[model samples]
Target chain A: MRKEDMVKLISAEGFEFVIDKDAAMVSQTINNMLTSPGSFAETQHGEVTFPEISTTILEKICKYFYWHLQFASGKETEFPIEPELTLELMMAANYLHT
Target chain B: MMGGICSRKREQLVIENGGCRGVSERFCKIASSKWLGNSFSRPIVDCQPGRGKCPSLMDLCIYKIREDIDKYSSFSILPRDISQQIFNELIHSRCLTDVSLKAFRDCALQDVFLGEYPGVKDSWMDFISSQGSSLLSVDISSSDVTDSGLALLKDCPNLQTFAFNYTDQLSEHGLKHISGLSNLTSLSFKKCDAITAEGMRAFSNLINLEKLDLERCSGIHGGFFHLKGLLKLKSLNIRCCKCVTDLDLKAISGITSLKELQAFSSNITDVGVSYLKGLHNLTMLNLEGCNITNACLESISALVALAVLNLNRCRLNDDGWEKFSGNKNLKVLSLGFSDITDACLVHLKDLTNLESLNLDSCGIGDEGLANLTGLTLLKTLELSDTEVASNGLRHLSGLTNLENLNLSFTLVNDSSLKKLSGLTSLKSLNLDARQITDAGLAALTSLTGLTHLDLFGARISDSGTKCLQYFKNLQSLEICGGGLTDAGVKNIKDLASLTLLNLSQNCNLTDKTLELASGLTALVSLNVSNSCITREGLQYLKPLKNLRSLSLESCKVTASDIKNLQSDALPNLISFRPE
Candidate 1:
């Protein structure tokens, strides 16, 4: 992907996951952070730091973003979620408004 | 300089005080430090002491507000835009209940589109109305707001638009409350039955009202009399209002500024249409299914600005078609199911600006199509159920801009397919005729841009499937001709772009067809009804996660089997046959 089309997401543990802007936009909150008229620091730097979200959950969210894009284009498949991570994932999903 | 030094000391104190509390507290300390710095100088807000950089203070406040929304009672302290964003976020997440709604009471939200939101009732209007003059548009469609609840909006003086569609509880009395809102420009009460002719008296005061949609308002018969004073009213839709008659049209004719009138299926006739001759500015007139005959065309031709005219299913004949010769601006004309024959098409020959013409179910044939050759700008031509045969297809070959051609139920066959091969811009082609055989499908392989191809009634056997390879962009393919077999489906299995695949009535398609089609992962709607596929074929559909509507009617699969698959494999399936 082109550098202009990518975004860096830093988890609470400072683990960085560079992903496509289109995939990261699967989360409505991230889309707002990047495109909202306010021009927040995340939009300026092309990076967002989620201090409350852990590295594992952030990585899973990035995977889900890509899976969501694939599923939208008709490559329908199951998005597996382990039972132990369901609660945290649900909270993150709620925050992201995905 | 002294002020900046004091603020820096204060920020240091705040950071020390907030160091042990974690992220949210640290953000609060930073926000407070920024506020203190704002009093001293603007530069201090942009550059923090220790932190490399901080997010916009507005973003931080919005984040903080979202994290602890219930802790505060009112967002009145924040800027209007910040409060509005918070309100939108709360509403988007569906977390804004009656209790949480109190925080945005006076937040000055400009637009509130809570259409079809559950739990919305009369009580919520108080909080919505609290925005007062700041509220410009509100759509409470499908809500339970009665006249008493609507009365609360009387105080919002600057409110310009309101949509209360399907809010059946609103009666004539409720309209009286909004009569004072002269600034209101657009209002929609679609499918509202309680607003009768008497209730429309309230609209006389709305001088700036430009658009009014009272579609399906069965009670409003003589309502146009009250709308006479709405000088700025440009578009009015009273479609399906069975009670509106010739007298209503007469009352409406006085509004010469009217640009569009949709009175389809109304109780208006030719006499009613004659009353609209004064509306010279009218650009769109839809009298479809109205009792208007050919005599109405004489009056309609006066509408020099008419770009779209729908007279489908009207009492029109060929006698008055010459009246359409003056409508040079006509871009879209729908005369489907009319009594006009090939002779009437001669009048339409001069309408070179016509882009979309619907002659479906008309008596026009080959001679009629010859008159359309000069219409080079024509993009969509519908001749379904007409008498146009293969000979007429030659006339349409010149229409290079034609993107959609529906020749279904016509006499066109294999020989006619070659005429369409040159129309390379065709994206949607419907050949739902029994005469369309494999030879016909093979003749048009040059039209590679085809995205939607319907061969619903065409006879295409296994050998015919070879033509399908050229249509790599086919997103929706229907081959329910009953001639397709497992071998025929094998040719279509690789069409990765296919989202809707219907192979119903093909008795030769057994479980092998499903196995062959398993690779079409993008199939969202698959209909193999009346096929020989058994219950075992359901397993092959597990990979089609986007499959929502699976029709296996007249097959061995039972409703319980579909339910079992829905619970596990096909979790996104919404509609399944035998259920």
Candidate 2:
């Protein structure tokens, strides 16, 4: 729909990854921040700032979110990760709970 | 114009009533309209309807908002926060299955009850391990969960209640997995036959265990000795464990915190039951089929808090029956198949709070029923196979709430049916009387709410069977005898809700009975054994494909006839007995 309906996720290097609210909600942490019980800063502004997450790891997290959404809908495909990005990707996966 | 007028009056009511009920309907109208326009930040205000005198407009707005919210929640792609709320609703509605559990896979679930769910054993532990300490209570009773699956729950230190009844592969060793959960309070191993007395060593660390059920566990004989240190144990059930004797009760008799004990069909006798001498807090005790006699009742009567006492199949004669009259708190007393008689009825007159009394097959007769007249609160009186005829039923007229009365195998006939006409709330009547004829069945048409009617040996002619069609609520009809003919079954096939129909031993019934029974699409159980129907009659039952159990025993139908029948005929049949 509209760009305002989407949520903006800002990484450590000020790299903003804006996506549809439905796709971004595949990450449970982002979904909780945007739909917490009361009006917290992220829920009010529709934007979350992850200072600990780097630009590369946050971009991978956003891609993994879309992949999870497709996987949940019965789509079976390889979600390939490079050997060098494996350990860091796993760390970010634990943080985002993708 | 109506919307404007409704909004204007709603604004006035909102300003008057303020916070609780009338919390501004204008906000809901704006929020609902925006929710329809792709905005998901709709304020969800939870409210209990009919709590206050809110105006109809506000209630209507809440109803419409809830309807829209329900539509939004049913979608598969809901946000995590909103899905958790919807998950709570699904749990309350008892709709959580393996398929639905995937929707909230990321959220930490509080209670998971996968009892008897297929293929839930292997991956269930893997899923709970992901929960990471939010799991509190789980009941995987009668499922495929084994000891290894239960061992995975060791990480859940806060887990309180775990029930693994009928988990076939789980042994006493599997119980060792749950030893370290210090918060574990209740454990049920009902018919989980792998648990022995040695397996109980796993539960020695559970200091908070309050209730333990070991019904039908054959391996548990001297397990009571292992539970001596559990001071908080209040309820224990070891029903149908034949080896448990009075000596086992003597080992745990010092645990005065015991409130409920069920050892039905165990080898415990008067000496075993006497060990429960001064357990004042004991509320429910079931010693049905135990060898306890007259002397055991002397000590049992002292437990004043005893509310439910089931001595079914026990030898509770007249001498032991005298000790029960003083225990006024008894609400349910089952002395079924015991040697109690009319002399025993005089002692039960003072039991004013008795709600359910089962004296099935004690030969209470008319005189015994007279003594039970003062129990006005009696709701269920089961006197099946007793000598209490029509004359005794007049004493039951005062029990207005009497709902279930089983008078099977008595002198009840046409006159006896007239006696039951006053008890309007009777829902189930099992009159397996040989003397009841077509004339007596006419009196039964007045009991319109009857759901179960069993006349096992009664002779009801085809015309008399026509009178049964008036009971449209009848779900089960059993008239297994030699009297019912093809025409009698044909007249009663119009009962669209009939699920179970038994016409066994009706020798005069022919292939015409099959033709009429085929139209009964709702019939699940159909028994036409000992009839004159041959292989030709098997073709007529093609329409009864929904039958679950079909018995053609002693009929003229051959094994070759069953082989030749169409493959799709009676496809849902699970039980088939043919001759």
Candidate 3:
């Protein structure tokens, strides 16, 4: 993928994940940060760091992003999630505005 | 200063169009140039919504450039809803130019009501065409929209209601394109004089058309023949179509589902009403000034489902209204300015379900109203310009449900008001009695629920208005031709809910009254005609933000005072009558 079409997300354990910018921007908080009039430090380097989110949670979030893309396109299916991660995922969703 | 004026004008436009709903909430978002108090950089960057928090450097540079260019238009940084509100205000104010409209390109608008705008033309439609399938309602009334402009709307599929009233440039060819919009429910072509019988043929394609108003489209004679297939049409108005006789009514009589048909000022007579008996679903029928008589009333009596009927200014007498007794389901009966008398009311008294009975300017006196006393469900009783008096009010005392009562230009004196004072549920009372003075005004103090009280042409003085001060819920108070002065208005000043105050012909009113009137922030229409108010008195009325119509006619106001005052004093003023 072109450099402009992808973004790098760093989790708390320093695990880096490169995802399509379109999927990453699906999160309203990320969309606001990426498209806001004033440029922030994250926009300058095309990378975002989440200190509070762990590597496992971040991986689940990335998977959920792809799932959202499929669901928005009228693909109906269950988005399976581990019962233990449900509370953390919901908290992340609240912060991100989904 | 221009920003201030434009911002206030925008606010006024929104308030005018939205009527105190979303207008004020939307206006609160816009910060004008004066709000900065000398404009130190203007906070244009900070004014940006939260979504504008972290754009790339390239995007930031472009946004900065655009903000600098949009220096005068203070709503540059608002969100889509606020921008849409400003766009609405801009269209109504006739200030929406092509350049300014570019700002709201991303606005997701559902309804675009650009009615009677002088600046709008094909470009506005071109802008609307870009709104895609989301546009649900569009009113381009009295604009320069021609056939070409309407052709642009061919791409707008979801447009359910389209009104082009007085946009007479549109013809049969223009209407043919949109006729295929099966989802369209209402199509108003009122005063589009260019439309002929050929244009009406397009309506057959509008399968879902529920309401169609062709009022004053006199270009066609027998147009109902084309609308015969529009079986879904529930309401149709052909008012002022003189060519529409009983023959046209016979053509549209096939529309059995029609619930309301307003053919006011048409050529349809008694013969035409006879054709409507087959339309069993018709609930409301207005045939005012149609030259119908007792024969028509007899024919209309067969429509048992009719809940409302207006026969105002018809060639009717006592015998005509007698026929109405058969259609016992009538909830509203308007017989204003008719030649009917007490004998008609005797027959009408059987219509116990009647909720509204207007006998204004009818020859119904005390004896006639006695028959109406049995209609205990009667909420509105209009006896203006009749021979009713204090004696007649005794008959109405039993009608506890009476909410609106008009005894204007009647022989009702001080004693009459005493009988009416018992009606605690009376919301609106018009006692334009010539003999009414301060003596009977004390009795009205008990009516705390009164919203509208018209004591016009009465002899009530300052003391009488003092008694009226207790009616805190009064939204409208008309006290013309009285001894009401500044002290009287001081009592009037506390009624904050007052929207319409007609202190006309009260020659004793002066500056003190206007000073007290400044506190009426909710006032919309104020008429101080033929008063003693001087030009200097206007300074006291500067705080009336919602005041739209102010009539100072025959007052002592000078041309200089009016000229000296800025439009900001009464920014929403549309009608200003000064001598």
Best by TM-score: 1
Better of 1 and 2 by lDDT: 1
lDDT of 1 by residue, B1-579 (tens): 101111122343334222322112211111122232233221312221123332222333344455566776876765566577777766665667888888888888898878777788999999889999999999888999888888999879898998888877888988898899899999999888777899999899999999999988888997779999999999999888889999998998889889999987889999999999999899999988899888888899999999999887797779978877999999999888788899999999999999989887799899889999999999888888889998999999999999888887899989878999999998888887898999999999999998878887799999999999999998778887889989898889888898778788888899999998899988777878888989998899889887766788889999999999899898667667767
The sequence of per-residue lDDT tens digits that candidate 3 reaches over residues B465-488 is: 778777999887777765888888
Tell me how candidate 1 scores on lDDT.
0.80
Deviating ranges (above 4 Å) for candidate 2: A1-98, B1-128, B137-151, B165-174, B191-198, B225-234, B254-257, B534-546, B556-571
On lDDT, the leading prediction is 1
lDDT (CA) per prediction: 0.80, 0.71, 0.73
Q: In angstroms, how far off is B456's CA in candidate 1?
A: 0.4
lDDT by residue (B355-388, candidate 2, tens digit) is 8898877868998899999998887788876898
Error of 1 at B17 (Å): 66
Give the winner by DockQ: 1
